[model samples]
Target: MSMHQAGIIEKKDFDVKPYYNQLSSRTTHLKDIFEIYYRYEISKEEKFVMTPGFLNFQDIKKGTVLANSNGADVVADHASRLFMPLYQNQGNDGFFAVRKIPKSFLLVSAFCRKHRIDKLLPLLPGISWKSKDKDVLRVNKRVARVFAKQLFHLMGYRSKTWNKEYLEVRNREAAARYNEYQNEAWFRAAFE
Candidate 1:
């Protein structure tokens, strides 16, 4: 089987990616691509450079000072695409580095998933489902190298390191809170 068919490829090669990238590319001066950056408060001496309502999607370099809150200098340790530069004083996320995901990726993924193509994922070596719902995925480092983080991110999965042995991926959309009472009359009446 081809590597591409086996979920081994670069972000651009992924058939199921997001559409934001495609649309943003066509528009001029539109900064829509982004990823999350959790804010870390290192010292009380540091001060923040951003303010609420500040424009987002600024490119940030590794080791560049981001803020000086509470008299301490806060610098970015890694270079990345910056999005949602935090302007608030009360949140944990400092900003998000977002990028556009092409719409075709979404379309293709939906089609494959609809046909149960994901059922084939576990058949590959070093891959398996962690939960009964089969939504949580675990993959070894070898497979992680073949399928980069962006590939799983495109598939609506958020990734986290698992015990230094595997990469654990969970679908963000599937992580939504279960509203079991949605179909109940009282729940419907409350909304109405």
Candidate 2:
């Protein structure tokens, strides 16, 4: 891992030996990628920089300060470093549609994972709006459980599998309401 002053995202190799011994069923880690439903500034490279002391529940917005290892404040990059300790299958048919997984995840996760992420999120109310949206969970065990998929999008989740679904607005009232949702101050605030 490179020596970051205070706020660089560092990575380390996780020993999968014990993990292989204990949990032998599903072995998914950072190697997988996802996409945000919309765009935010932090999406860079392929990973989003998670804000310090924030939970995975809310969305990231503009003007939010994110941290690196040296404690330097950077305008959050719209991407995140994913750690897939087990996946090395980066063929052309790979999901990322880019190079094989960057080493950043392995290097950065090493340093960042040391800090407990428990209290880091469930994002704060923003200057423009507050979020009251309830969890939109379904009995929907469709695929990719956990908030990682959303988080992937928030960061630099890029994949052949992820694409933005475009919507068309034409109805006057519906358009107005759609505009309301679009322009909601929360757009610059956090996600539910």
Q: Tell me model 2's lDDT, rounded to 2 decimals.
A: 0.31
Best candidate (score: TM-score): 1
1-192 per-residue lDDT for model 1 (tens digits): 234433455447665434545645655575343345454543354455553343555656788676666666667777765666766666655555555556677666666644556667789998899888877889998898998786676566785766688899887656644376456553455334
Q: Which stretches of candidate 1 lie over 4 Å from their true place?
A: 1-28, 31-33, 37-54, 59-64, 76-82, 102-116, 177-192
Error of 2 at 173 (Å): 42
Candidate no. 2 TM-score: 0.17
User: lDDT of each structure?
Assistant: 0.63, 0.31
Alpha carbon lDDT of residue 43, candidate 1?
A: 39
62-129 in candidate 2: lDDT tens per residue? 54554332344545344432222112323221111112334666344333323422113224221111
Q: What would the TM-score be for candidate 1 when compared with the true structure?
A: 0.56
